[model samples]
Target: MFTRKQFVSASVGALVAGTLGACSSNGSNGGSAATKASDDSYTLVQSGKILGASDLQYPPLSQMNESTGQPEGFEIDLLAALAEKMGLESGWIDPIKFDAIIPLIQQGGKADVGLSAFTITDERLKQVDFTDSYLDSNQGLVVKKELTDDAEAYLNQAGRKVAAQSGTTGESWAKENLPNAELVPLDDAIQAMTGVSTGLYDGCVADLPVVSNLTLNSYTDLTVAKQIPTGEQYGIAVSKDNPGLTKALNKALTEIQGDGTLDELKTKWFGSNI
Candidate 1:
């Protein structure tokens, strides 16, 4: 039997193959970002318990840090802001794989919503509904600084070994754009960068901020080579059946952006008003 890790790496790629589209634009709130879908004509469930889940990897958005040894990143802060707006007390479950979040909601109704930095894609849309975009995340490739000039050449190469966080949009982008390349999925950006450092993978594909975080501090040797037109957007996800949950969250998300609360949080964490 394939282990969960191997199965996730192998089958999930096949499961999501060839079904990505341009990500939606960020919301006015600047606190959250998502696809610009026609608003769901559903009602927010008055039931009070809202569950939040995120993969405990990928820094500046969601990752473990040396200074805190706990999960602290942009997404967590953003979600906290979202929760404050809704007056909803959220119950957080950690270490869930990105792919499993939708299923957990669909099957168990385990979470009222998901709070990970999940990208919006049509393939995922079939499984769960998404709120308006809260962030704009362009796709990018990170490699050793020396290979900056050879990025386009590398993308054109066959079997280029690229690393990504398991079940992330980065992994999905690699499957769509570089199908011929060997996509090596790690658990987090730290490991992804480590793979590049150890010569285990030629490069990594991830959101611009993740690549930025990697290069800005620890991974000095790594640099972003090419920016792919992923037009990626991140949003909160809920079961399509939960129209009520979706509506309330979307409203809350919108208010955050409209009132500049989102911008405040963005500046606090990111240093530039997003």
Candidate 2:
């Protein structure tokens, strides 16, 4: 899981909209034979492409490259590889609101799959099916330098304002674990981190990897105060209407894991940190 500070500007959004419009047009006319699957065991929103939906606001996991107006990250690479393994084109990745992805997939005819860093939980299983676990992660707390080092004590302090990304596990964890603390839900992790950096919030909660990345690379003034090991596992979500697709994804994931491809990817992205 990860989050970046930049959002799609109006011009960038227009560019993306134009690109997707072209994709839709070409998809109707068989853009590429590679995207067309000879076998009909599974369904796809687009015939010749695996349509993937992601927020594209998360870094390392997924983020938009402003220069190309396209997404690039570990999850994007993995999804491309998965598409290749399934005998489809590189795949059409559409940037969407993170929380809207699940609902769109469940409603059908939008995307073939959701490739964000979605943690597998019992509550989510009721809405959509998930493939085998890919990444294991946990929640983390980030705060300014002056806060007490004792995370528990800091959280217990009255009137402490904490921030978390809306609709994320971090938000839920903060609400449950720091009931007395004021909870501020923001659109993305960057906003939460910004809140902490500007003293708008006492601290912020987010995925451990995200907090670490932001602190190390972008928000140097901030630090990871504590790590909350929630034992979260990320997975690819498939529509409940497409069990066959889920099975196919699991098979591909197993093959990749067994062949060391997954390890190579982890090493490439996480380096010595893994």
Candidate 3:
């Protein structure tokens, strides 16, 4: 019932709407919560807190506890330490989709720094500058224990289905490398894990932390089939021009890594320092 031009407009509108829904800082982007910090304020440098992160559901990094429903994870702990070291008050932002986080920062300046287990890559670097590597995670494949051998035998299987969260490095890697496989992009880690468990997908591609977390706690049926360890790592991200913020973040990050807070949190969550 829609004309070609009208359909195109509608599709574009939908994408925008979806992005806004994911990145809205506060209610309808209103109130004190929605306002951006003033550049003239040095307090914005030392004492300023900028919005960060999307949702807290990626385990070991950020996740809401199933028992207590409280949010706790490695990234949250690291952010807390960084905030204290930087003399800034950390403001928590709500549930933005993973892919929307970078776009919001680039186009809208939505968050000051994004730390959602984001992988650092050459392709992503063109869009935004990244903090030094805070977490190292290789591209990994998770498959049913029974089908693990199949994936090991044939790295790419035509007519088979692979799943990953939209806008993530996993999705990009799968699309690029697994060209023969049907790729399904879900919105979050939970969905990707569930898809494999439900037999809706033959395998799921994700970061190592995601593979470990799901295999240990949620998806017992799944196991890591292969790991692409070309030395990929995750980093905190900010707008390219915001060198001041990046510098401050790097200082705080260095302190955390030096004082062993990062490793302490890593061991607590992951059972080993990654």
Judging by TM-score against the true structure, name the best candidate.
2
Q: Assess each prediction's global lDDT (C-alpha) against the native.
A: 0.69, 0.75, 0.72
Give TM-scores for every candidate, taking all chains together and pairing residue i with residue i.
0.76, 0.82, 0.79
After TM-score superposition, the amount by which residue 79's alpha carbon in candidate 1 deviates from its true location, in angstroms, is 1.5
Candidate 2: what lDDT? 0.75
Cα error, residue 10 of model 2, in Å, equals 46
Candidate 2's C-alpha runs over 4 A off are 1-40
> Whose lDDT is greatest here?
2
lDDT of 2 at 128: 95
lDDT per residue for candidate 2 within 1-274, as digits (tens), equals 0000011133246456674221111124223222312122455666646778888777777888889988888788888777766666656556877788888878767787888889998988899999999889998899886674786568656899999888889999999988889999887787889888998898999888778878888889988989899999999988886776787788778878888888787777666434
* Alpha-carbon RMSD to native, per candidate: 14.3, 10.8, 13.0
Q: What is the per-residue lDDT of model 1 for residues 79-196, given as tens digits with 9 covering 90 to 100?
A: 7777666654545665787678878766533455676778888887888888899888787788888889877567546767888888777887788877777888876677888888
Q: Candidate 1: what lDDT?
A: 0.69
Off by over 4 Å in 1: 1-49, 65-69, 155-159
TM-score of 1: 0.76
lDDT of 3 by residue, 1-274 (tens): 2222333345457557774232112222322123222221111211246557666768778887779866678887788888778665676676688888887666533566788988887878899889899888877788888877758335477778888888888887888888888889888878888888998888888888878887988789888888867477888878765654676677888988899988898898888987
